[model samples]
Target: MTGPIWLQWFYVLFWIALISLMAIGGYFMFRKFLKALPKADGKSILDWQEYYIKETLHLWTDEHKALLNDLVSPVPELFRDVAKQTIAGKIGELVVKEEAKQLSQDHIIRGYILATPKRDHKFLIKKLKERNIDISPYQELLK
Candidate 1:
């Protein structure tokens, strides 16, 4: 109340800018921290995901790739690639576990369902239905 109007505005703007920068820095640091953290299996989560995806990259047909792109279409553009990679990695893990010779539509659908969180199951169901993929087989997983 004692200072000039301009000085008061400058003080408020300075604090706002400082807080914003701190928040941005904190976000980056948190991401770096997560990337370094090891998972229960000894490898960092990102490393495992990359390994699974690379292991089965040769098996993914054009159709399978297209289907994954379609499934991730609803995600925002900024995060779409990460979403695709995560889902693809999960699918690859499934294929490896089963020692399957080739990827199938069933594998893709099941992987998508499992990769997504439970809170998003409704969206998953709607998306799968839109593609005309049966959800009956995954009813238990969804719950």
Candidate 2:
């Protein structure tokens, strides 16, 4: 009692369809898993910037480090917090004075320098000056 030829063919086709569907589903699932995984290199923009700043600081001469320390030291208590904002503004002023352009013209570098601790404002200004950034316009801010 063999099955009808047509029935046998139907069974074969049905199994083929099921297995094909399973393979397709598995492929899609694997793709989704890969998409969920983090990038292989794993370094982000912030991580790169932090590395750059650390390397830059590490290469500074002792004189440069001392100058930076002097620049960032805390102001009087009354101006401590406000000083950061003031220094950031002073940076913008310096950029405009030297380049004849707004700080927004080089927002990334401006933002990076401005993100430093308030005490390091002078350090950032000095680094800019070393690059021929001309901080004379903002010198009054350091007073």
Candidate 3:
């Protein structure tokens, strides 16, 4: 009759297995849910378009978003931040140009190029300078 203890042990083992499976499944589902949810903070390139709203889109909103989306992926997000007064007007000229500048990876800042990329870094600096961002000292590095 004490052999019935084996059955109890079996039941306990089965319960432990089931509980573990449920917990693992729940955790994975939660992770997927978080991925699918919109990241309105714009912390990543994938979060930008999701956060962009009709009201926030200004002056060729679709176009700006289309171009802005290019900085990331088919689903763009970003960590960029700006003065939150009126994002509409500021988004296009101010943000767009600055975003383009940032995308080049040249790190153009105040008439100087600090850190440069490996390949095409010169081209990026040249492009920024052509846009009048002023990347001069780094050009000397080329020499």
Candidate 4:
């Protein structure tokens, strides 16, 4: 309150700039930390996902891939790629588990549901219903 008008504005701007920089720096640091942390069976989450995807790449038919894209369409463009990859990774895991000959609609639906956060189940349910896909088989997962 005792400072000149210019000094007061400068103080405000300086704090704003400092906080912005700190937030940006923290975000990058957190991303690096996540990438370093080990997940499933000592593999980092990224590595685990990559392994599943690579192992099942041959099984992802064009139709199955398109369905996956449709399932994640509700996600914002900014996060769609990550969402798609995560869902695909989950789907890949399911395919491997079942020893499936090829990707199926059921596998796609189950994987999308499993990979999505619980809070977003409503959106998923709506998407499935819109596509005329039966939700009865996956009721347990929606809950």
Candidate 5:
């Protein structure tokens, strides 16, 4: 049983070294494979915001569409053709800044409702109530 203890220890060390090398090789190969994979087009955050808004507009309520249109209505004439989503993205940024203390849902709803014109206040309030939004905080604005 003790014929060659040193030889046994050498074999164990050799096996451990071989396994480690294999693992390292596999890791490098995985890295190389990942590097070869195609990357997503380099869209900016604003671009992504625009794309999402454009794509999802169809799903929005009529009130949402009107609100978005109102939000972008003040753009300079030269850039009028700019995508609605781009304008919406800017409004979203402003809303987030203006209502930093509120929950995201509240801020988004309040921002859109607030931006809506006084003429549309009753319509906006009605739409929000239809959607089951809590309009208690915005009652004064709706008045």
Candidate 6:
């Protein structure tokens, strides 16, 4: 049973070939994602976060009744990378927020805010602050 037979050798080669193909396929997929990621608006996704915020604001006015005017909204003119980071859920919220913070250190408003129900916005902001992000800059700007 231990002897090297043609069939056994062929089986071993087939498994090896399959694994090699899978690895190559995975790499190709990752490469395609990277290429498409920065293609939006011809800028990095990070740069487009602000655009999302604007869209969110417009959606809010057009889609729902205004309830809490005091509630701070995210900056309508800043990148929403933090919100996007949380979105992927591929990485932890803390990691993504930290990266977003690092990018927006000087701006003072760092992170993303979506137009969720008024009830959840507070908890969401609290969660962001726990991650060491400040939505104040955007909030203040929104008002």
Local distance difference test, per candidate? 0.88, 0.51, 0.41, 0.89, 0.58, 0.44
Q: For candidate 1, what is the lDDT?
A: 0.88
Candidate 1 residues 13-87, lDDT tens each? 999999999999999789868976998888986787899999999999999999888888888898789889889
Q: Order the candidates by TM-score, highest first — what do you get? A: 4, 1, 5, 3, 2, 6
- Model 1 ranges with Cα > 4 A deviation: 1-32
After superposition, which runs of candidate 2 have C-alpha atoms over 4 Å from their true positions?
Answer: 41-143
| Candidate 2 residue lDDT tens string, 78-107 | 654444344344444444446533223243
Evaluate residue 82 in candidate 5 and report its C-alpha lDDT on the 0 to 100 scale: 52
lDDT of 3 by residue, 1-143 (tens): 55698899999999999999999999978865775565566353224423433323443435444333332221112322321212222342333545442222232121122222235355545555555755564556544
Q: If scored against the real structure, what TM-score would every candidate get?
A: 0.80, 0.28, 0.30, 0.81, 0.34, 0.26
Taking every candidate in turn, the Cα RMSD to the unseen true structure, in Å, is 2.8, 19.9, 12.5, 2.8, 18.7, 14.8
lDDT of 2 at 54: 40
| Per-residue accuracy of model 6 over 19-74 as CA lDDT, tens digit each | 99999999978865674477645865444544444433322331121112222334
Q: Alpha-carbon error at 92 in model 4, in Å?
A: 0.7
Which candidate should be chosen as best, given lDDT against the real structure? 4
Cα RMSD for predicted model 6: 14.8
Query: How high a TM-score does candidate 2 get?
Result: 0.28
Segments of candidate 5 deviating more than 4 angstroms: 1-91, 95-103
Candidate 6's C-alpha runs over 4 A off are 1-4, 38-143
Q: Which 10-residue span in candidate 2 carries the lowest summed lDDT?
A: 100-109
Is 1 or 5 the stronger prediction by lDDT?
A: 1
Model 3 CA deviation exceeding 4 Å by range = 1-3, 41-143
Best by TM-score: 4
